[model samples]
Target: MTSEEPGDSSVVRRDRFSGGPARGFLSSLAADERIFEADLAVDRAHVVMLAERGIVDGETAGAILAALDDVEAAGHGALPDGEDVHEAVESAVIARVGPDGGRMHTARSRNDEVAACIRYRLREDALSVVEATLALREALAETAAAHVETTMPGYTHLQPAQPTTVAHHLLSYEAAVARDTARLLDAYGRINRSPLGAAAFAGTPFDVDRERTAELLGFEGVLGNSMDASSARDFLAETLSALATHAVTLSGLAEDLVVFSNRGYVDLSDDYSSTSSIMPQKKNPDTLELVRACAGDAVGDLAALLTTLKGLPRAYNRDLQRAHRHAFDAADVVGEATAVAAGAVRTATWNEGALAAAAGEGFSTATGVADLLAMAGVPFRTAHEIVAAAAPDVEDGDDPATVAAKLDAAAEGVLGENLRTHVNRDDLEAALDPARSAESRDSAGGPASPAVAAQLDAAADRIDADAEALTAGRDALAAAADRLETEVDRRV
Candidate 1:
């Protein structure tokens, strides 16, 4: 305020407008920290491209690049106030290199520059989410491999449906998370494209090499349409949608663990648990409860973001500035939640005996019994009816002799034949054993130990492939950084 320059106008405007109170509301500088480094990199690439195209002299490009290095070292906090990071960065450069610094903005506009910066920063965030999800899948697969035979009750509608192993349950989640990871990676493909050189939606008059800038910045390619390049925020929306879906998966896992802990079928380690303020015996899974609630926040963010963009006209609006934070916030929320879920799953301990005991409760083995009768030449519906009749007399796995007697009597009414006419009594007794019932399920992806082993092998192969893909992505980003620095060194 003390300087000769008017606070209301920027370096580019040079005091054309008067100061007002609404400057605070209009300025996005205070909340632009996430894109600070990205803005620097994009600015650097654009400057180099301008020099190579003879839009600016080589010496001037070197000086501007040198000034940018100082600005970066001084850090974002030292930036002079402006409407956004792009202006703040330009102002800093002009201050360092004097009049020659103005050459850096020759063929660019804030529209294209901000779009490029958002993509540069968001690609990293998207990759981080992918890495966290892959780690969670690895944890699930590892835990499941160790418990291929650990029997548990699988439920539908919160009631015991059948006997299944812990491996089967955990691997089911692994499959769900794998699909989420795929969505994130697919979104990353779209997010990494360069939007630089578009120059205010219509593109630059100066013969700028869009592909050269993209190469320097690690973008897979340039966004072909200048209007779409600068105006499109669909990639942002897609990323948030992917994260919200993953958060739903995370909530389901949290719900299952919470219910399992409640039923004494699992115990979360102390690292992931909490005690009540007043109740002495309370060991609550508070971390998981919070994780379950994170899904709502993610969904809310997605809704707000989409609502903000519902009817805006194309090609870079100021509203875009307000929209990015929703995507950024959702990505952060889901990323942290994914890591917490992975840790909780890895550290948890399953109660085998309790799970097994609960597996056979409430005639959970009724399906297995019905299957046995159907295999014995009785119509499948007749078998189902006979098993339902026997269910009221005794639990399927509790009293084998009582269940057998009831089944034969029920058969007399339903089929007019004894149960032993088809299946031997030994086979009848074996079918009533929950553990034996699980063992006999040798179908692909069944609860049997052998089937679970096949699933483990498939899961390992997938985790390895995803880990390699993530590593390749990180390597590409690192290589781009190195290439940009080397080229900058040549210019400086």
Candidate 2:
């Protein structure tokens, strides 16, 4: 390889052009700065592995490792101009230790090195996302626990369908976010594998201990196939998919809160809400509206990533460099959105009287009455017809006695008997009461208070277990870094 003079361009361009406007078009330095620390760590691990495999002399490995330490101290911005951080770091290492520094690239190509660096940084990024999700879940669980018996209307097609508690509604979102956390943790399993020794699109000729480097980097294991290792980016797509799903869950929660605020069913904290510039009476859910928009952003990021990976052939491509920007953006947007949603839920106040007043509107307990008549041996369809016939008389302002008289007349017309023959007035009134209607649904996973209590307890347990898992992962990475640093010290 021909060496550029000291004052010449340090970039290793395959084309004839050394420096020009094209370099700016191809440069990834701005994005590459995100993974500079990971790049140095990969160098340290790779150098230690090389010396252990007898591929480089101890003195040369020590010199390269020490120079890498200097380059790290100088930071990514201090490096010479090049195509990317990998080239810039390599150029810095070579400048520090002369020709022997080139030995750092002996067993690995930029393809596998860049891949490893991405995985190294993304594992932590994914973990941070999971942590944010857990915080949101905890916030939701606490809010649900506080409102386990606060009766409200549950809707389908945005119309009242049944009576439910705020706890039941909030727990539903907690369930979805729990699944989102599981998807991310599952993706982490594959994302944490090492691709260090694949060397380019093929295995290196030198005998390299891929497992050793993987262990030193806290990866669960090495990616077995060299070509697949160099080309695979499915893990990134999988993570963004999980994030997009999570963002959708957040969007639903935000939409519901916005609707509740509109209906006077809930009041958001002033911190999360915004006032109109001219209309002094306006207090808008601007934070939630932005969170709802973030769902679209996450979905777009996932689409962009899948589209980028869709047509690329096996082995590394320049196109793969653009992939990280999508992953980083999706994770960041979703993470912040998750936190904002948690804050909104934690600080919002539910209007119990208003929610209860609306809960029984639209004859929301009609299903409960039908269920009660069916339990007394009336055919369900017959009972449904009897209630449907009397619904017009049971209007918004009618007294219970008048409503019952109308229902009795309807029942006699439908069944040729008074409605009291099979059920008493007390039973009928209990069935019609929205609070009793919600409380009557005591089956497992129902919107009843006891069911919601069980769900909230289960959510607490899941949050604790997931938090511990994240902590264990971080501890393992710290231990690996400690081991790597100790080994480097011995080699130096």
Best by lDDT: 2
Which portions of model 2 miss their true places by more than 4 Å?
Answer: 1-7, 14-17
Q: All candidates' TM-scores?
A: 0.97, 0.96
Ten-residue region with minimum lDDT total, candidate 1: 1-10
What local lDDT score does residue 224 receive in model 1, on the 0 to 100 scale?
94
Q: State which candidate has the highest TM-score.
A: 1
Model 2 residue 227 CA deviation in Å: 0.6
State the C-alpha lDDT per candidate: 0.89, 0.90
Candidate 2 per-residue C-alpha lDDT over 333-359 given as tens digits, one digit per residue, 9 for 90 to 100: 999999899999999999999999888
In model 1, residue pairs whose N, Cα or C atoms come closer than 3 Å (at least 3 residues apart or on different chains), thus clashing, are none
Which residue pairs clash in candidate 2? none
